[model samples]
Target: MKDSTQGTSPGPGTPLPDSILIVGGGVFGLSTALALAARHSGKITLVESSPTIPNPHGSSIDTSRIVRADYAKAAYATLAESALEKWRNTDWGREGRYTQSGLVLVSSGDQFGKDYVRESYENVKAINPDAVEALPTRRDVERAAPGYGSGLHVSGGYVNWGSGWADAEASVAFARKKVEETGRVNFRTGDVKRVISEDTGSAAAAARRKVTGVELADNTIITADLVILATGAWTGRLVDLRGRAEATGQALAYIRISDEEQAKLANMPTVLNLSTGMFIIPPRNNLLKIARHAYGYRNPQRVPSPADSGSNPTQTRETTIEVSLPEKDVPIPQEGEDACRVALKEMLPAFADRPFVKTRVCWYTDTPKGDFIITHHPQYNGLFLATGGSGHGFKFLPVLGDKVVDAIQGRLVPELQKLWAWPESPPAAAPPPPSSSSPDTVVWTEDGSRSGPKGMILMDELAKGGWKRSSSKL
Candidate 1:
C-alpha cells in the first residue's frame, strides 16, 4: 500500500477528475480533505472564510482540552482508541497527553451518570486490561489525591494510563500541515453563498451532477465534483442542518484557580461533575478551564436559507445568525462563572482565594438527546453531516474524522449507525444559496502536477496566503 502520509495518486479510470471541493476549514473539514488527498491525488479545494482554526465562531478551539476513550458505547470507544493510538505514536506534532494528570468522571450513586462512568471504565478496560483501574467511591477520589474534597467525589471514578489532555490548537495545526503536504487540498478564502448540484440522472450522473462548483458573494462559480461543509457555527444556515441547529448555542466562563489551587487539582484526572453539569479540566499554563454540559437553546433556524442565498441578487435577505444579533448578544450569564468558581472552591478549597485570570465564549452544537447527531442530509446526495456533537465531542474528533471519511466515501460505518443515519424520507429541497453569502472569486488551478512532496509544499503556501485574509468574525 502507498504511504498514507504521502499525497494521493490519480485512481483508475480517466485519472479520477482532478477536482474535489470542501466547504469548511474547521478541523473536520480540513482533516477529511487531508485524508482523502493522502489517499487519492486530485485537485482538492477547501473554502474557509475564517482566518484561523477557531473560526471566531468555530467550536473547535479551546485553551486546553482532554481526549480519552471513556465511552458508554463500543463504537465511540473504538473510535477514541484509534485517535489515542494516532496521537501517541504519530508525529502529528505536539504530544496530546498530560502524563501526570489522570482523567476522572464523577456522578451521584443514584444518577444516570453512574452508568455512563461505569460503562466508560469497563469499556476502556476491555480494550487494555492491564492499564485501567476503577475507583468505586468518593472516598477513593480523596484517597487517590489527598486534600481533594469529598464533595467533588461521587459514586464512581476511573483512571486509565493512556488518556489525558492535549493542546487543541497544536493538534489542529498538525493536521492542517498534513493537508498541505498532499498538494491536492487547497485552502481558499471566500464565503460560500451557493452550493450548485448538477442535475444528472444515472450512475453516469455521478460525473454529471457532481458539484458544478460553488458561487461566492463575488459571483464566480468554482466547480468541483464533491462538496463537504465543515463550517462550525455557520453550518446550520449554510446547509440543511435538520434538528441539530436548533439545539446549538454558545457557552462561556472564567476559571479563577491559581497554581496553588491547581496543585490541589494536580495529578488529578479531568473532572466531569455530572451533578453540576460542570467539568473542571486540569490547568494549562496556570489556568483552569470550566464549563457546563447543559442543553443549549440557540435558534438553529437563524442561519440564512441557501435558497435565499442563490436567488435574486437585488432582493434583501435575512440570515438567522443569532450570535451576532444584538438581542442574543446578552452575555453568557455571570452566574455561570460564579457557579463554576464556587464549585472549584467547594471541591478544592485552595481555589477559594483566587480570581479567574481569563474568560471567553465558545459554542456547542447540541442534539435533543444530549448525545451527538452525526447523520446524513437527505436533500444533498453526496453531502454528509457530522454536527450535533453536543459538549463532549472534542476528545473523539480523530476517531470521528475516520467515521466521517467512511460516510463520505459511501461506506457503512457500523459504529456510526446508531448515532448517525440518513432520514427515512426524502428531505425537502434545500432553498438556493442566500444572496448574503460570499460572492465567488476567480477559480485558480494548479499550473501543473508535481510529486506528492512538491505538491504538498505548494498547497501549504496557497492555504496560508489564501486564508490569511479571512475574517476574525468568521
Candidate 2:
C-alpha cells in the first residue's frame, strides 16, 4: 500500500483535535482514519470488534464489489467518477486490487424512454462522454456478450468501460497497513458498547451536549476529543438514530467454475439487472458472485431469555441484542436463490447449472433514502457519524474519506450539508407483506412469518448434501 500522506499535510488553518477515536474497522472507518492521519497532526485510534480490520462478516468483506459511475442520481455519479480516478492511479490500483472489467446495466422494460437505466446512462455520459458505450439493440449487446441473448433482455443500456470492481477485503487491509505505517494511527481490537456523554447542566445543555468518549464491552473507556461511529450495520445498536437507519441482511452466493469456464466468461462485464435487483459480478479465483440489491430483510431484535442465569451467559435476562449474533450464520433466502436463477438463465445461461460454492447473508446499514449520513450528532458536541452505506457505499472507497474530513472540519458546502444531515422525519415503515398466494412477489418481512423465502434452508444443510446443483432448468 502506498502512503497517500507523503505529498500532503494538514493546512495551516483550522487544525482538527489532537486526538480522535474512530469505531469500526470497515471501509468507512479505515478510510476516514487514513484521511485524517494524512492531513491532521493528531493521534488516530481505530477500534474493531473483530480481531481483523476487515471482519469476515463485514458487509464490505467480500471477494469483489462493483465500482461504477452508473447512478441515476448525479451526486453519486460525481463521487464515483472521482473515486475511479484514484483507484486507477493509487497503490491499490497498481497492485491489481481493482480490476477494470467494465460494467453492464440491464433493464427489463423498454430501454428507449425515461427509466432508471436511461437516466444512469445519461448521467455517466454527461460526466465522461467516452466512458460509456450505448448498446441500443439486442445485436449490440449480443456482440458484446454472446451468451446473454437468451433470457436476458437488453433493451437500452450502456457499458461503462471506465468502471470495474475492487478486491474489497484486500483494499481494507491495504488501507489499514498504509495508515498504520504513517506512525499516527493506533489500531485496536474491542467492541464498542456505547457513546459516553457528560451533562452540561440545564442552562448549557441547550447549547450543545458534550460527548466525553466511548465505553468498550470489556469495561475500558478510551477518551478522546472527538469520536466517530463508523460501525456499519451495528450503528443503530449503539445510537438512538431515531429511525434514520436500520441493519438489513442481504443475500450473496458464489458459484465455482473451472479455469476454462472462467476464461470463456472473462469478457462478461459485471451485470446489474435493475428489473430484478440482482447483480452478477465477474469471476474472481474461479468463483462468480451473485447478490440482491433490493430491500433486504431486517434482523430481528433479540431479547435476553429469563429462564437461565449463568455467570457468563451470552445474553443477560434483561439485556437484548439484534439478530445476527457474531457467531450466528444465515443462508440465502429462496427469493434470492430464485432471483439469481432467473437472472443467470436470462443473462448468463452458461452459469445456470454451476454449483454453488458458498453462500452467506451480508448486512448493510441502510438509510430511509439512499443518501449517506456523515454529519455530526446534533446533540453531542464531540460525536460524529460516518455510517449509512446503504449497500452502495463501498464503490466510493477512494474519495469517501475526504468527504468525511470535510464534514469534520465544518467545511462542507451547503448542498452537502443539507444532504447528509439527519432526516427531518422518520422514514416510512417497510411495505406490507404480499399475499401468500403470490409467493414470487412477496418480499422479506421483519416478522418471522416471512423470515425467508419458501423452502429456505441454511447453507449448513446444503453443505451436508455436498452443495450440489439442481438438474432442473430455469
- Per-candidate TM-score against the hidden true structure: 0.74, 0.83
- Report the alpha-carbon TM-score of model 1 versus the true structure: 0.74
| Backbone clashes under 3 angstroms, per model | 30, 2
**Residue 469 accuracy (lDDT) in model 1:** 15
Tens digit of per-residue lDDT, candidate 2, span 203-227: 7664456677888889999999999
Lowest lDDT block of 10, candidate 2: 305-314
Q: Model 1 over residues 146-175: C-alpha lDDT tens digits?
A: 545666646667767667777776666666
Please list the C-alpha lDDT of all candidates, in the order they appear: 0.55, 0.70
- Residue 406 of model 1 has an lDDT of 57
Residue 158 Cα positional deviation in candidate 1, in Å, after optimal superposition: 2.9
